[model samples]
Target: MTGRPAPAVLPPSLRGWLGLVAAFAASVVAGLGIRYAGEGEPGRVDARIGAAVDGVGPPWRSVALAMDSLGEPVGAVPLVVAAVAGCLLLRRPRAAVFVVAGVGTAVGTATLLKHLVGRTIHGGNLSYPSGHTAFLTALALTVAMLAARRRGRGGLGLGGTAAALLVLAVALVAGAAMGWAQVALGAHYPTDVLGGWCTALAVIPATAWLVDRIADRLVDRMADAGRRGRR
Candidate 1:
């Protein structure tokens, strides 16, 4: 008897899903902890950190200010749009969808959480989560995801893995730099930045999974149509 063909190993999506779930859980837990720590009072940590960060000299101030702008609409929107366009141009419709959904969800969630939690730091306007940090982080992550996906099928082996890691590291550094700017400018507390980062982490993978599911359906449909045509 002829041996059956070996089953093809599917690419791993479970790890991404699991990571998204864990991040969502962590974001919830951290938000609650921050709320509890404030306890209807202004956050002392916010005040202390704000003061320390503000004390730095002009050179650092210039850098912080530049990083802070990255989270603003003027800076962030273009980058996001360009990344999405690039993915579409490359025929990665799924990755493009993930970029829009992931970034949009992260920003929307941050806004919603701010309202729901109704907490503030030093009495300075809905400060539970930093919107600027959320936007910048989401943008950074989207770029990294697109880069990794683009290179994934190129058979670069270990080099591909290293390149992906490097992209992720750079994205993270950019996010952290923006977070520091927010903190230094006294625009948000450290916990607020943490919340934003966690939210992005949660949303990106969830969106990626959704997009992947849609893409799989499309591929299956096309394959079936091709088979029918051949008949």
Candidate 2:
């Protein structure tokens, strides 16, 4: 047929997007698992949940609270990536600006959810939609979107299979590690991370597509303006 590679299939579709939303809702339910399950006697889930709900303890407690501080690393990360993307743009390089924008979207969404959803921190804030969880999930999403964009580029042989596996691995690891860290530090009820991941998974794929359309239009407009200015 034509020489052009088959148009890359969008990795996620409408049904898939809805499924992701359902999954996030499921995560919210699952976050309560530690509350019911995780049998470590009566005080197990409660103790940890209480800790997170109450916020950090005294000075000593704060120092040891790496999980709570996971946001620090997450926040620091997008900055560097955004800067790199900016550099690429400066050089007229085809860098991924969507990835940076995606992080911003996650952050903005987290802020809105934190206030609007009225979910508490642990008790007062609810902590159902964790910022820590959102941050990690968003990072994984960036990797997955970038990988999907790269598909069918060189060839779809063994190399392609290996590459796909690698991309999935990266996304899973990043998402999972960040999620677990929050759980470990007792900063979020397990459900919070689950909801966070589910929400992110649902949103990122559509965003990737939307960013492409918007960027293309901006590029076209820029070219048109350049032509008129040269007249």
Candidate 3:
């Protein structure tokens, strides 16, 4: 009997995925650019425009800013706790590495675009895409993906259901908090944050699927190798 390794197929092209990604990206650029550009100069989502009409002033604005600032740290706490627990239970040393890479690449893309766009920059406003929001979203989504994948393999269906719910809730809340912080802090226009989210998710879906597929293949390969070695 002849023995040979199976061919590896990294997804996307096999599923007409690349075309969809390109279309989505083009749409994001057009939609976000138009909405953000229409807003006129950028600064703290123009809280003053509506507030002045309402006759609101001072500490209220300050309070809003403070709340925005408060959200990031608060949201981050859940992720940190989950990550620590993951370390103890799953020992996935590469989790943080992949997360950092995804976030760093996303943030860097935002920062570069912010400068390259040549829009006015003050108080974090030269925004095509909001970096802070994107960073947190990337982290949140990545963790959620990891949690879901692990849950799928666990034998306890009830526990897995609970785990999946918890992961989804945390990721959604954290991601929303991050977006809220950017909007409240006047760090970016709502359009900028939305666009950044689109960009991040667009990159993420394909990458995440590929990573998961590759991981499964690698695990199978390693197990096969171990069995061969034993024989």
Off by over 4 Å in 1: 1-21, 24-48, 55-57, 122-124, 149-168, 222-231
Lowest lDDT sum, 10 consecutive residues, model 3, at 1-10
Query: Could you arrange the candidates by TM-score from highest to lowest?
Result: 1, 2, 3
Instruction: Tell me how many clashing residue pairs each candidate has.
Output: 0, 8, 1
lDDT for each residue of candidate 2 in 46-143, tens digit (9 for 90 to 100) = 45754554444566355436544646766557554764464354442222555566666775666565554444543454465567666666666564
Measured on C-alpha atoms, candidate 1 has an lDDT of 0.65
**Per-residue lDDT of candidate 3, residues 77-134 (tens digit):** 4655565466335545445445555555656676776665544435444767766666
Evaluate model 1: give its TM-score.
0.76
- For model 1, residues 1-231, the per-residue Cα lDDT tens digits are 122121111125234443644476466737665564444443677667667775457899888888877777887788888877876776656667777887888899889878777767556478767778878777776666555443343212324445456545755776688788888877777767877776776666666666666666667777777788889
User: How good is model 2 by TM-score?
Assistant: 0.59
Error of 2 at 113 (Å): 2.0
Q: Tell me the whole-model lDDT of each prediction, alpha carbons only.
A: 0.65, 0.53, 0.53
CA RMSD per model (angstroms): 5.6, 7.6, 7.1
2 or 3: which has the higher lDDT? 3
